[model samples]
Each structure stands twice: as structure tokens, then as C-alpha cells.
Target chain A: MDMAFDALSDASDEALLVLYGNGDPAAARSLTLRMGPLAFRVAMRMLGDRAEAEDLAQEAMLRLWKIAPEWRQGEAKVSTWLYRVVTNLATDRLRRRRGVGLDDAPEVADGAASAVERMIDADRAAALQLALDQLPARQRQAVILRHLEGLANPEIAAAMEIGVEAVESLTARGKRALAALLEGRREELGYGHD
Target chain B: MVMTDEKAKGLALDDFFAAARSDLPEPSGVFLARVLEDAEAVQAGFAAVPTAPPRAGLFARFADLVGGWPALGGMVTATLAGAWIGFVGVDRIDTISGAYFASAETLGTVNLLPDGDLLALAAE
Candidate 1:
């Protein structure tokens, strides 16, 4: 009965996933609600477009639902698996772009290329997102997972299918690039003194 | 002086990262609905691995009513035994019990009873 599924807010994601595999619909609803935002946020960070981000999030969640039945307990965390899925999907989308790649894409933030054209200065987050979008796919993935998602280096490594040193290297490079891109916007973005 | 400048640069970037974190894009209601729909669709195709068998049918219910197969077996054995007892004549049974007890006057066997009242007591 649906009524029997109450008090399930505290259940871990893996526990809920196992329940979903066992044909419990409540578990599905709860899991989707919990993990959907994470997928969307990461996808948005990796890919600047909202439409594509939503699609990737939905696709990642679909994969999660499909893998429910065979989800091995204590083998891996649900969030980590989800991070891997989102990053891989975003990477595929990045690769499929027409005439766009690490070397080919513009290095500067869109519209913030020169001192004459400052970032709109209304939204710091938007300014940061624009800078992040200019980064390579791997660096973006590492930065989003490490800084935005607050994941550890090892966990980011596991998610990105890379070594811990690679994760560190990507984040360091990503931060340096971000700093350079946003350096011209210090006064306009409201961080004049800092 | 250069280290100080680098520290300020790091601090500025940290502020931007914090803004991005706080300004996370919310998943639209439509997006949530679509995902839930997808989740339901995916779950629907799953082969339900029931740990136990399906619901009980009439015969199974009856078996349960009779306290399961062992109880039913015992009841059948008892019914057959009663039928057999009814089919046998009393005289034949008396012969067997009387021979065993040595209480039959015609058997000429040694009398083994204080009183010839075993079957009567058993019946009582």
C-alpha cells in the first residue's frame, strides 16, 4: 500500500534504489526527487544550456532507474555513480558539437573578451558560468565536481574515471583559467577590495 | 607581494564559486514531472522478483483451513482406519483381542485377565 511507504525520507539512496528494483513505486518517486536536482545542477554546470542539461539529467536518471535491479549493495555510492553518468553524458555532448573543441573554442568568457566589453555585472554566478563554459570538458568536470559539488579528489577521480593527480591538475588549471577570465570584472562584479 | 596578489586572486575566485553554488539552477516542474514519468515507465518494465509465490487459490485456502498437508494426510489416514474398523466384524476383532488377552473361553488359552472387561473399558 502507498500508505506503508511513509517515513522513508531518511532512507539512503541505495536502500531506496533496492526498494525500487523490488517494484516499489514510492521508492522511485523519492529517489527521483532526491537525485534529479543533483543531476540537473551538474549538467547545467558542465553544459551552459538549460535545455540540454535537463535532457542529460533525465537521461542519467533513466539509467539509474534501469540499473536499480542489479544495484550491488556496498559496492559504490549512488551519488558517485550519478556523478559519473552526468559527467560522461556531458562529455559526449561536448564532443558532438560542430566546429567546437578545446583548441577551437574561444578562450575568453563570452562578451568579456576585452576590457571594453565587461561582464554584464548583474550576476556573479552568470559571469562565473560563462568563464567555466570556456574551459575544456575535463577541467570543467573536475572543477564542478570538486568545487561546486564539494566532492573529494578521490571521489571526483572515481566519477571522472581519472587518477587523483589528474583531478588535482584539472582543478588547479581550471581555477587558474577562471581567475584569469574573471580578473577584469573585479570592480564590476562587486569584489573590488577582495 | 606576489604571494599576496595570488592569495587575493584565489579569494576572488572562491567568491565566484560560492555565488555559482548558491545560484544553482532549479529543476523546472516540467523537468521533474518528465523524470518521474520516465522513472515510472522504467520501473513498469522491471520483472517483479517476488520472494514468495502468488496469492492462494481455493484449493490452497482449503488446505490451509485443514492445517496444511500433514494435517490433511492424518485426517485421511484416520478416515480410512475408521472405515476399515467398520468393515471388520466384531466377532473377528474379538477373536484377535481375545486370543492376545487369552480371555476367550473357546480358545482354551490361559486366562490372562483379572476380569474380562478390557474392550468394555476401552469403549468406555
Candidate 2:
């Protein structure tokens, strides 16, 4: 097991995907560890539901597993590819929601934080997620990928399958919309106290 | 007061965004297991290694060559076997008899049978 971990540590995601295609269980485990949370968080933030996010994460990972054999080395980062999958899947679900929004609060695990800090973080994340859900799907995706996921415009563009200019436009508009939605809720969100 | 309040609001928003991103949610063990299961299911169906049985017949070998569909491979093997038995098998029989004819004169010269007797046996 340690040897498998060692073999996986230095390997690139593409190489790990190749290993996975060849039925290396360690590669799948490594990919799940490395990419699962990212997919989960993106889906959770985008959809504002834990169960749906988990489903999307599973679907995206399943697609990755299916495509591993044909995955082109160095053509794309595995994370980026999963991001694209999650984005598309989340977007499809959003469309199917038809504006009947599901306002389920996101599930956040606060490891090592105090009770008060966890409450504060959870409240703030809930507020941000509410604001995020109010934005258009494309704009919401762009903002989540940019601000929360910390992805660059080009990567966001690739994930969303849009032009870089479109990514910038969507993110700018989305942030402005978020600010508008979140502006007066400072006190309610515990931001005024801070 | 308004300018100060605006600056505070901006700072608060920044803080909010920061706090929102600070801690990501950990996927539950069940969720991770499901993802792993998905990977397992997909990997099972994927041909990680070529499926060639070394001692398999021509059709099975061909099927393995073309990506290991046993039914299709079996059909191909049957077709090749039929062609070989029907055409090449007859040709081989004719060649064996032709060799017998080519050596007949030398063998018959030993008078194992009289000329007319040999002719009658050859006709038979």
C-alpha cells in the first residue's frame, strides 16, 4: 500500500489515469482523494444541495473512469476535465430545475475549528450560496469557479466551454449580482460584527 | 460616516468571500465509496489488457486480435475452418494420389503383378 502511494505520489494525473485504465486500484483511490472534494464543492455550491452534488460527483468520476483508456496524455489536466464534467452536469440539473430553486443549505465540514467559528463559517457559506443560486447558471458557474475554486479565467473558460472574455464578463456580472444580493444581509450574516 | 461605512461594507464582503472559501466540505465515506464503486464498474468493463488466449483456435485468436468478442471470433473461426476443410482438404487428397501415380511405374516394374493384372488393379 505504501509502495502504491509512493508510485502514485510523483505521477501526473494523466499518468495516474493511464494506470487506472490499466486497472490500477491505487490510481482510482488517488484520483478520488485528490479530485472528489473539488467536484463535490463545485457541485454543492452550484446546486446548493449535498445529495445532488454527490450524485454529480459520482457521475463525473464515472465519466472519468470510463474515459481513462482514451484519455490523451497532457492534452488536459484531469482536474480540469472533471471540472468540465461537473460544470456541465450541474448546469444541466440547473436547467431542469426550471427556476424552482432548491434552497437546501450546503453541507460544510469544519475540521479543527471551534464551535463558534464553525457556526460563523456555516452561516457565511450559506449566505454566499444563497446569493450564488440567485445568479444565472452560467454566471453562477463562472463565479464559483473563479472565486471559490480559484481557477483562472482560461481554465474557467475551458470548464464552461466559453471564451475567456465571456468568462470575465460572467464573473464580473456574477460578483456584482452577489454583492447586490448579499449587501444588506451583513448583520444577519454576522459580517457587521466582524 | 457614509464613506467609512462603504469601506467597511467592502471589507466585510471580502471577509465573507474569504470565509466562504476557507473550509471546503469533506465528502462522506459513503459518497467516496460510491465514486470508487463507479470506478470499479467502469474498470471492469474496460479492456485494460488485450484478451488473447494463446492456445485458442484461429477464430478465438482473431476475436482476441480484434478486441475479444468470443461469439464473433467463433463465427470467424468456423468460416475459416469450413473453407479449409471443403477446398484445401480435397486438394491435399488429390496431391497424395498424384504422388502415388508419379511413383507407380517404378513400383510396378518389379512384377508384383502381371501387366494385365496391374492394369485391372489400377482400373479398380
Instruction: Say which candidate scores most in DockQ.
Output: 1
Task: Assign candidate 2 its CAPRI class.
Answer: acceptable
* Tens-digit per-residue lDDT, A1-194, candidate 2: 77897889888888889998998888888887777778888889888889989988888888888899898887788888888999889999988988474454332334312343334765677678777877888999998888888899999888888899999999888877777777766545555454
TM-score of every model versus the real structure: 0.70, 0.70
Tell me the tens digit of each residue's lDDT in model 2 across B1-124.
8787667766766766787798676788899988888887788787545687558787667777777786776777899877876876755645665697775434214466678998899999
Q: What is the interface RMSD of candidate 2, in Å?
A: 1.6
In angstroms, the error of model 1 at B48 is: 6.4
Candidate 1's C-alpha lDDT?
0.84
- For each candidate, what's the DockQ? 0.45, 0.44
| Per-model lDDT | 0.84, 0.78
Which portions of model 1 show Cα errors greater than 4 Å? A1-6, A101-122, B47-124
Question: What is the TM-score (0 to 1) of candidate 1?
Answer: 0.70
Tens digits of lDDT, candidate 1, B50-114: 45778899988888999999998899899997787679865566677788877645334446664
